[model samples]
Target: MTLREFMVQRQPALCERWLDLLLADYGEETAANWRRERDPFANPIGHTFTTEAPRLVEAVSGDGKFDTVAAAALEAIIKIRSVQELAPSRAIAFVYMLRDVIRGELGTELARGAHATALATVDRRIERLALLAFDVYVRCREQVFRLRQDELKRSVASLLRRWHGSELPEPASEEVVHLSPPPNHAVRR
Candidate 1:
């Protein structure tokens, strides 16, 4: 069979192995959701893994072109991983699992195989995906950092507004009672 035909036949198995490796990183309880539920709303992670992973494998296994959908799927998965307690390396390690899965799927065929070139092509595709994943991971972290910085800035601005408001004396009887500042008074921090 041609390499493309082989990859097509093995796509589902590849996704399954990749998902199994990925779930191994999480707690048993959390990982079980991925193995159990297939609903997108009920189990988004599982749905993404099962659905996107195969699409990604199919896309890359074709011509190794960069597909926006595949990249978005990778980004979504990475975004989820970025929030977890995993180290950055651990969070992105799932990308490398593709290599092992591919290797395992074509073991005999790859050994003294006339399709060595085709096998190398698949490996390169996985490497490209890994690089894309690293980029996604960096972006995810920067987005998280930006959000935190924005929140902090807002909180500081609010506190300053409150402190300044407190300094401006309240109007009496809820009316526009204007009063001049106390003579010779200066506010200091």
Candidate 2:
């Protein structure tokens, strides 16, 4: 199923997890404040991570599915961090803002006396947002990987230069080298 459909289907569980995390971070009082600000918008979306994102992540540790969701959330968080230099709490707040927008626009009934149409419209919108969020997450991850790879290359090059060894090959110019398989030993008699 699509990510949006999966999230919607598992909304209740996810929300519970998210709530647990929020409470842990901000304590009951801060969680209550978050609920006041966020719960209203969460109703229509069928799921939310407002207070529960971190809690859900903790619950999913070592479980593959939860790890996947956490990875996506992390990537998105990283992108926001790189661009805005936000503190972790502030970055999470921005995630809530985006979630609110999705919930508000995609969870609303559109037009009068057309419930089916409204549902379809909302589904489409949610799917779109899911795609956008996923893309943002991927792009952020790719950028991070590129940065690390570049740093590693630079380090290796510097070490080689310091040793006064033969010039190291350019990372980009090096092709992926695969070893050939050994010849088969058994033959029909």
Model 2 stretches with alpha carbons more than 4 Å out: 1-114, 156-189
Candidate 1 ranges beyond 4 A from true positions: 156-189
**True-structure RMSD, every candidate:** 15.4, 16.1
TM-score, every prediction? 0.78, 0.31
Error of 1 at 4 (Å): 1.6
Per-model CA lDDT versus the true structure: 0.73, 0.43
Stretch of 10 with least lDDT, candidate 1? 180-189
lDDT of 2 by residue, 1-189 (tens): 333443455556545554554344545875666556544455411124443344333322222223344444444334544444445444344334434433443343222543444344444433433443444544554555666776688777878676766666555414322111122311111
Q: Model 1 compared with the native: what TM-score?
A: 0.78
Q: Candidate 1: what lDDT?
A: 0.73
lDDT of 2 at 65: 26
Backbone N/Cα/C clashes per model: 0, 5
